[model samples]
Target: MGDGSLRRIAALARQDARLLARDPAPLIVRTLMPLLVMGFTQPLFRAALRAGDVPDANGAEQGVPGMAVVFLFLLVNVVGFAMFREHGWHTWDRLRAGPARSFELVAGHVLVALAAALAQLAVVLGVGGALSGLRVRGSWPALAVVGVPLALCVVMAGMALVALCRSISQLTVAANLLALLLAGLGGALTPLSVLPDWARPLAPGVPSYWAMRGFSTVVLDGGGVVDVLLPAAVLCGFAAGLTVVTLVFFRSAHPKLTWS
Candidate 1:
């Protein structure tokens, strides 16, 4: 990329960060909402597990681990909030018309989203440790290795949505609906084993499923770095595929129009 292009991308990132910081609602929803949900739901989920309404594979030990997956799914949805906000302000259109390349613009947003995801992940992990006594048997390095790329995939998925959405209202509705659906199907709301057999094959296709599986393996199951490889690869593929599809859609939508 040229120096001008690089600078434009940096400027776009700075602009996005400033805009996000200025909006208290988006900030709260993106950062604090997940933590709030985790705080409130943890008790109920624990109660459910104890009541035998929800079977625990590892007895009470699964509570915190299970909640970890929930927290991660929340983080993924939160990180996608920027796309909705950008659509509202038409900032994406403006940025695309500027010196920044599509990749650079996408990259900048992904970085911001990654940072938000990591920050929320830290809060969730800390709360799990303090309140629920969740354990992390895997190396911190391995956790970070899996986490960073997952965040990137999530952000790229958000950008793809932004490119495809026709309006802010549509974007908001779609993002929330997609988040809820993915969370439910990906074992964030319930364990994969509890899902019907027909739904089993579809789980691997959803990015959240791969993410929750990878995270649970490393953090809860004490799996090694190699164990996370498949899920991580799936996430990477999702990111790449979504990026290409979004670019194509964006280009086609923004094509020059002919006037009579």
Candidate 2:
């Protein structure tokens, strides 16, 4: 909107970034855990491919990209805690008392989360490729198209959680459940084709499902940017819809009470 508001959001985002960097738990959970999971699964994926059992996946490619989708849920939970962290530290009022509006504060969290999610996804893919000998076999930019939307969706969803839940525990429980349920139903835990008949139709509805499909199109099919455009558009829609919902929820909420 206004230049002042833009400046404010940027400054606040920087502050939020500092706070996030200082937090070790989010670092371990968001950054390290996904890499660890991918590393552990690489051997299994390699074996499956050799046996001609893991359909549509060649060695570490499937398992590695798969981890990116799975960790998105975890990223949402980690980013969603930003509001609670401020609330716990009793800094929300201070921000609100100054030039910051609730939107400003929420936007800052969104910015930080967005950047973090993108970086986190890259780390997972990078570690998979470097340490586990994973290959892209397709356009790197195409993969980024999938990643951008996934990151946006997580950030928007996390901001919504900040508005909806009152306490860190409440937010954590709800976000984790949501992340896990989406992962389970959306083919992050397994392939969509392998899912039961009844679940097939529903799998397409989840954001992560689109992410997996897009990734597979690029990595497994050796498809290009044009092929991934559909899933990229789908993910963008999810991000936009979640953004609207987050705005509405955060706007209607009185931050002082919501934070409490």
Compare the candidates by TM-score and give the number of the best one.
2
List ranges where model 2 is wrong by over 4 Å.
Answer: 43-58, 251-260
Write the residue-wise lDDT of candidate 2 on 190-241 in tens digits.
6555667888888988898899899877877778899899999999999898
- Model 2 scores worst on lDDT over the 10 consecutive residues at 251-260
Could you estimate the TM-score for every candidate?
0.78, 0.90
| Index of the highest-lDDT prediction | 2
Error of 2 at 167 (Å): 2.1
lDDT of 1 by residue, 138-198 (tens): 7656666666666667666666766776555555567677777787778677655566788
Worst 10 contiguous positions by lDDT, candidate 1: 251-260
Residue 231 accuracy (lDDT) in model 1: 84
Which pairs of residues have clashing backbones in candidate 1? none
